[model samples]
Target: MEKITFQLPDDLIAQHPLERRDRCKLLHLDSSSGEMKEHVFADIVNLLRPDDLLVLNDTKVQRARLYGVGGQAGRKVEIFLVDKLKDDEWLCLVRPGKKAHNGDKFYFSAREYCEIISILADGSRRVRFVGAPASEIMEKFGRMPLPPYIKRDDTSVDRKMYQTVYANEGFSIAAPTAGLHFTEELLADIEKTGTEICRIRLDVGRGTFKMIETKTYEKHTMDPEEYWISEESAKQINTAMKKGRRIVAVGSTVTRTLEGCFQSNGEIKASHDETDIFIYPGFQFKVVGAMVTNFHLPESSLLAMVAAFATPEQILTAYNFAVANRYRFYSYGDAMLIS
Candidate 1:
């Protein structure tokens, strides 16, 4: 993956989404011929066929970012909820790591407090909410978990702008970005074209936004995230596959869910499970044929996964074209459709 690198101009990073969601730029990549074209994201409906199936990750984004003071001396701490362990316990990434040691106490409000009980192997803290369940505390105080690259504070607009129109189940710290471009009207229009829509859940965790820090790609390990494919969704997907219809994943998370649950016989099982699947250039894709995704960070796993779908050469070429043409990059940015 070290070879999979790019130079992203600082100005290319989109700090905010366009006023109109579907108005974002779309880069079309033809995998077989390696040709590329630019169009508005709304044109996605025209690019699909009647026999195509669009799979979406409907994981809802939780308000996982928190700002509060901790320790007896009242030091500031930033808590990013990573996982919920139980009703009262949660696994979180805390700033000032040295101050969040075992037995440390953090106060969110006068009535809501948390105490670190143990340390996880990955340096995340396992803490117990003292005054209320962790979920309730977060609901009352947590802010939208915006990516650090956005360079702004979370605002009231983020509650709606950061979420996809169809998002409804599972708690994800981050949004399934490609879905962000779809409006309810656009989805209805897509359905009228006979392109069936199916859904799966993959809770986007803290690791999804982190850049690759290892010297070699082999050292990168994905933390397991929970996912589920319903019996109904499996039936629709299997029926489409049997008929030779295309399965178009909406984002990298959906791609991960489809590939992780795929069987050798080309069938997807309906069940809830955790997957740490890491995709790169040479991995065989079992379920997804096409995908809708956002431009990702350089040297990131999401970029590597896209590289696998469309060859590294094609993906990088398209990216260069995007940069030259001024397409917005990152979560609140433009979209790409590869087939």
Candidate 2:
């Protein structure tokens, strides 16, 4: 774990995204050689081969953060929905947790409200909606669940900017940041080069961003995230594998989904399941020949996985290069393609 830790200046953290998504910087690293070159994100089109299979996670970030007033004092409260427990019930993290004891009611609007049903061991609340459907209330009042590192209140712009253009299913709490750099025009251009693009789904959960607190990567545990692959996409992937084509994963989420679903028979089947797959240095990768990912936080599971994909020495060297070059960092930051 110490091998992956690095000193990052706070000013290098990207507070907001650029006006044009594909206009950001792209750092191309040769994983085997540890050589690096910089390019515009739009230059990704020329970096691919016709036989490469590009897999993207199309899981969309939900408007999961909500603000309301509740408790005896009518104090302002913030609720971040973590997962849907049932039709109208959800597991959530409440701000001022002491104010939201079991049976306390909070109102989002005149017609939309929720009552705390129970408090879980981890201190998250089990809440049930009333006066309106949970989805309806969230759609009306919830804000995008931006990562805490951004350090700003989410605005209307985030409703569009934080999501990828190809997002087709709403489930994740965070955006697949690597995909955030792509645009419809860029996807079309990649397809024109005969690079086959496919989609998968991985509901990004809090576990994806959880930092490594343990001294070693072996001691850290990953929370399970739900993922799915369609029969069409499965067949495409299996055929590509059989033909020895390169499988380029769009983000860490896609990388995990593909590598997790791989079977002992050397083929991936169409299926839906949960994965807590944690990749580290020494773990053999069965899928994902290359990766497109955003710069990850220090000592994060995301960075650990990137280190595993390449070598920790090579990845850290490239990261230092990126920092010295003044490349942006984090979700709304620059990207890297390791191949």
Candidate 3:
């Protein structure tokens, strides 16, 4: 309920997504007193103990940014696919929405066709691609979900650099920004040091950028992000708990995916479903003991989640330091660890 102020400088906002997926700056935090220490992304290996279990989100990002014509030429429309309907169909939000209507025809690059089939009750439009497989569709006309800060269009480097190296299962519209900093070498070093790695999938939506619209963080319900916890993942996390090892979540998405399937008896069951779990202060964490996340926006859901992990004062202090140090902010920016 405190006043949230974001006075970050414009230069601190990362102009582009990281050129190398794993090469990012990191700030380690002591969850005890909230003290911070700066380090490179690779230094993460030192934080892992042999008995630690780390969970990662393997959900791949789809090229959600789509460009097309409205009912006529020169009426440019941007359809950002947020959720899937079929291989070549999706539920998306359209820009220049005034020009879109059911049964209207649209074009992608003047090369392919799109039709507005129906509008979903929640306001996303049902769109069908007329000429190509959705996988190939993005290769032609889709762009990455570059945060609104970049001030430019997604470039050639974004296609690869925006996603994590381990990303494979496709569903997410935006990259798991925290995982963007992990290199194969870092993963290997952590594994070599006896830390066990596991995976879950949360198809995070483009609503990731949505600002808090409610006065109370408790009042805001999260848009359901698609999630999957496999039998293997559940077994690993539950087993780690049974043995009293720490379970660290790589990002808020991973934290949500794992916590979504958890039961009150401290058991982790495997399931695939949508998750609307919003973690805020006063919530008891069921799975994650530590979290590696990115610097978040003020008065944002992401920052509220961090407040749940540590404390509001701790997070505010870290934010002030990040701003003072000129650390890059938001999705394309530096990383943090609260443990």
Find the candidate with the highest lDDT and give its number: 2
lDDT tens digits by residue: candidate 2, 1-339: 565877899999999989999999999998878888899999999998999999999998999999988877788899999999998999999998988888888998887889999999999999999998888888999999999999999998888989999999858999999999999999999999999999999999988779888888898999999998999999999999889999999999999888888833356878888888889998788889999999999888999999999999988998998899899999999999999
Please give the lDDT score for candidate 1. Answer: 0.89
Weakest 10 consecutive residues, lDDT, candidate 1?
Answer: 260-269
Model 2: residues with Cα > 4 Å off, grouped in runs: 263-266
The digit string of per-residue lDDT tens for model 3 on 1-339 reads: 664556888888887866665567788888787688988778889877789998999988878788787674448788887777777787888877778888877777556767888977877799888887766777777888787877988877887878888998867877898998888888998999999999988888876877788888767888877777888988999899888899999998988776766743246878777778787787788778999999888778888888889988888888898888888888789999899
Alpha carbon lDDT of each predicted model: 0.89, 0.91, 0.82
Q: Say which prediction, candidate 2 or candidate 3, comes out ahead on lDDT.
A: 2
**Candidate 3's C-alpha lDDT?**
0.82
Write model 1 residue lDDT over 1-339, tens digit each, in one string. Answer: 446777889889998878899999999999999988889999999998889999999999989888768785679898888888887788888887887878888899997888888998989999888887777887899999999898999988899989999989778999999999999999999999999999989999887976677876677888888998899999999899899999999999999888888842347888888888888888889789999999998888999999999999998999888988888999999999999
Itemize residue pairs with steric clashes in candidate 2.
none
| RMSD (CA, Å), each prediction | 1.6, 1.1, 1.9
- Taking all chains together, each candidate's TM-score versus the true structure is 0.96, 0.98, 0.94
Each candidate: how many clashes? 0, 0, 0
